[model samples]
Target: MPAPIPTKVHYHKQARELELGYADGQSYRLAIEYLRVFSPSAEVRGHGKGQETLQVGKKFVGLKDITPTGRYALKLHFDDGHDSGLFSWDYLKWLIDNREANWAEYLERLEAAGASREPLGIEIRQL
Candidate 1:
């Protein structure tokens, strides 16, 4: 099957969101934190099946920036200092397709673990 063309793409820096438009007339707005927690990299996704890590304390995260990998993918830099995930067209589609269920699952896991998505381990010095 031939690849579908992208109609429009926008990155909102302050909002830390990526919006994509497709020729099929569907658009998606994805948060940087959502993409980070669901990264396809071994660092985030692990190397083997059933090894996915439940990323916590990342609800407030956002996208730092995006670097294009030619025309096929984007290298995402995350606010939590995670820059390993390279999102391709196919992967992005999968994420879009599964956003609702996956987000619900993440929330359920956090609740079950008695975990908070609040920030952790960062010391801020206020003068």
Candidate 2:
């Protein structure tokens, strides 16, 4: 069976959710943070297995832009200056279907690494 084509895509800034409607009568609402942490970029996925990087401190990340990528994927521009991930239809569907399990794994990794979902802060002083 062919993958379902997206009929509509809506980005809700207030909720930080990306809602997608598909031709197969299915829809999904994915959070921006989820998308950020599970990005398909080399920075996140890395060059091969066992090299995935843990993305932290993105609890409040927002979408800056979403651009189509040659009809097969989307280039997501994030407010935190991350714009490398290419989200394909299959990947998007997987995210939606496995959101619960994926989130659990992410949390576990964060806890194990003593990391956090809250963005870090930097203090600067005047010279």
lDDT of 1: 0.79
Q: Measure candidate 2: CA RMSD.
A: 4.0
Candidate 2: segments with Cα more than 4 A from true spot: 122-127
Candidate 2, 14-91: lDDT as tens digits: 899999998777788899999999999999999999999999999888898999887778888988889999999888
Give the 10-residue window scoring lowest on summed lDDT in candidate 2. Answer: 118-127
lDDT of 1 by residue, 2-114 (tens): 34545677887667678989978888899867887898888878889878887888866776677888787778877678888788888888888899998889889889988
Per lDDT, the best of the predicted structures is 2
Q: Where is model 1 more than 4 Å wrong at Cα?
A: 2-5, 121-127
Judged by whole-model lDDT over C-alpha atoms, candidate 2 comes out at 0.89
> How much does candidate 2 score in TM-score?
0.91
Q: Estimate each model's TM-score.
A: 0.83, 0.91
How high is the lDDT of residue 49 in model 1? 85
